[model samples]
Target: MHATHSSGKGRGHGGGRGFRGAGGWQQADLPPADDAAAWLTGRLPDDWFVGAPTITVDREEIVIIGELAAPEGSDDNSAAAAAQGRIGRFREETREARMQIADEAEARYGRKVAWGASIGETKAIFTHLAVPAMTRLRHDERRVLDTLVDAGVARSRSDALAWCVRLVGEHTDEWLTGLREAMAEVDKLRAEGPDL
Candidate 1:
């Protein structure tokens, strides 16, 4: 069954956690948005999506991807094209309203908001942020990235590293999910403990 809102559930691991890193480029403190999915579900209009959207939150942005109702009597061959057209129409139609919602969400959550729509096998994101992160790697790790770059698998070391990370993420999604759940539990326990 489709739900209008997902109560008490969201994939917001490091986004809401207070920032305590000592690096100059590290982000400032952020408001906890464990309920970001729920909040967005409730805040969005009812007719916007066929059901509840899948929301993903990180330290920099919140992305909401909702499934749009399929076009009636669309054949298999035309379905993808129809879906793409619908997505474009939806984007143009919802520009103003989406901006307003994004503004409100950004103010409330201290992170940028991005929206997307999906239909059948087609999916589209309206906007998203690509926040740069600084990292140092050992010789072995740098060699791995360099190998990918040398092989033309990536244009640069950064792209190679990103490709590697994406590969790892796709392969270990189940393990990552479990880890996130465990971390959420730890966060809950920490919140219940005495204030420092």
Candidate 2:
């Protein structure tokens, strides 16, 4: 469920707004200055802004980067955000400033003036998971689990696995049965790990 735009033919993925090309830095085609305020009058996408609450007028372009109103019918709460977006197609001051910045940056970094880079793919962004809700033990298993929790051995599924890896398996008459039972318990711990 993400909006995608091909910024360039070669740039097929990445950038929150369907930007796909390597060279095509898509900017919203703004209307005249008078209508500029009206441009953002209606509902805008939730994540369109790269900056917010301040609009800067440059020599060449109007650089307005900020969070916008979330579109209607959105399931999530679309309050104002500190997101950003930039408009420079019609202004000159912004262009010069950007060029100057790029020149300085390139000189500093010793690289090409590759100014507009398509944002990284949103889907590829890594995320952290909650660890507490992963494993659920039965009533009888709960007593033992509480002890492990107290010992800080299994705060998450990964923690549980680490604990199991260090386990001294019980010695029983049927070695295979004991190993099988231990493995079964490990499986449950893995599926319900807190970091899911």
Candidate 3:
């Protein structure tokens, strides 16, 4: 999923130092996104399935986002719980797989590559709650949030900002979907080209 911040800056550097692992791999040496996706797909258990994976290169990590497939014949509640449990049980295996990928990435990119995964619907399988993070906002941005609070859309500035985010997401669901699809395609194309 594309993360949005009021500052219009992404959380991590795209295609920068983070993408290159310190071990020796440079950006050019890193495997193509498609190749990484295929490896992950093959490594994961058949029972623990996922949709097409999208790879994101950040300053400190490589994130693979996919729809974690729910167990068949289960209701939403049971399916979610089951998925969580399964993921928890396989954490070690997942880490090993990620390390293997990281090794490859580091060898090729000349930097350390950290890997992460998200469950179906892009929900983090491990983190249970939203942790507080600090970000500096411009005067006008803060003012806009305060105005939203005054308007009664939320109880506080933070809540108001969250409300606005949800509203934007709801309204631009289709556009977001398209953007994700486009990113996947770009990954595939990058894989087909020469390394780097």
Candidate 4:
């Protein structure tokens, strides 16, 4: 049996276009994460093993992370290769379907959407973040880095700090945006308000 799961967090408008689902596939208002997962599962072939997906919404993008497995009973070497090949073919064949899903997700959440999958084991994907060269951390901040290292979330103190920064960025994205807008409004008011 094939099953899929998905989880996502974001703000949504009331209406969106029809999203394809496992059965008849229906149009709904603000389709939840489970519905999205079912829709994606329906698009995949019967042989694929799709794991639970973690979805994240950034300013302009929705990211989907999940694991995919080869068809069951394909343990032999040749069968394993064939299964891998079929997985690749599935990805190619479903390109348009993926785009459709992305479009629907973007419309529903008001953001662009991109997806990435891992065939088996999930590995960390890294992106570089630039910071000032002369920056220094306080003693307490250094202890926090040490704690993260002790927790094994990162390989080193620098990595631990980077992970912490990334976590903060992910969790506070919407709040940061709202803060920026509020600041912009405050600036406008300061400039345009009646001079004392």
TM-score of 2: 0.18
**Candidate 2 structure quality by residue, lDDT tens digits, 6-109:** 45342334444443222123322322232332333232233444433233221123333333333334333331111111122212324565456445433433
Which 10 consecutive residues of model 1 have the lowest summed lDDT? Answer: 1-10
Q: Report the CA-based lDDT of candidate 2 relative to the real structure.
A: 0.37
lDDT tens readout by residue for model 1, 51-122 = 888999877899999999888787989999999999999999999999999999999999999999999789
CA lDDT for candidate 4 = 0.55
The best candidate in terms of TM-score? 1
- Name the lDDT value of residue 96 in candidate 4: 81
Model 3 earns a TM-score of 0.44
Clash counts for the predictions, in order:
0, 33, 18, 0
lDDT of each: 0.82, 0.37, 0.56, 0.55
TM-score of each: 0.84, 0.18, 0.44, 0.36
Task: List ranges where model 4 is wrong by over 4 Å.
Answer: 1-49, 71-87, 122-196
Task: After the best TM-score superposition of candidate 2, give how far the Cα of residue 116 lies from its true spot, in angstroms.
Answer: 4.3
Report residue 100 deviation for candidate 3 (angstroms): 2.3
Q: Which regions of candidate 3 are displaced past 4 Å? A: 1-48, 58-60, 66-69, 72-77, 106-122, 125-138, 147-196
Total backbone clashes of candidate 4, pairs 3 or more residues apart or in separate chains: 0
Query: Cα RMSDs of all predictions?
Result: 8.6, 25.1, 8.6, 15.6
lDDT of 3 by residue, 1-196 (tens): 4334454233235433343322223333544443544665565455534555555543344555445555467677687677666556555556766667667765644444443445564345332224354667899999999998888878997787778778998999999779878866775675578875
Comparing 1 with 2 on lDDT, the higher-scoring candidate is 1
Candidate number achieving the greatest lDDT relative to the actual structure: 1
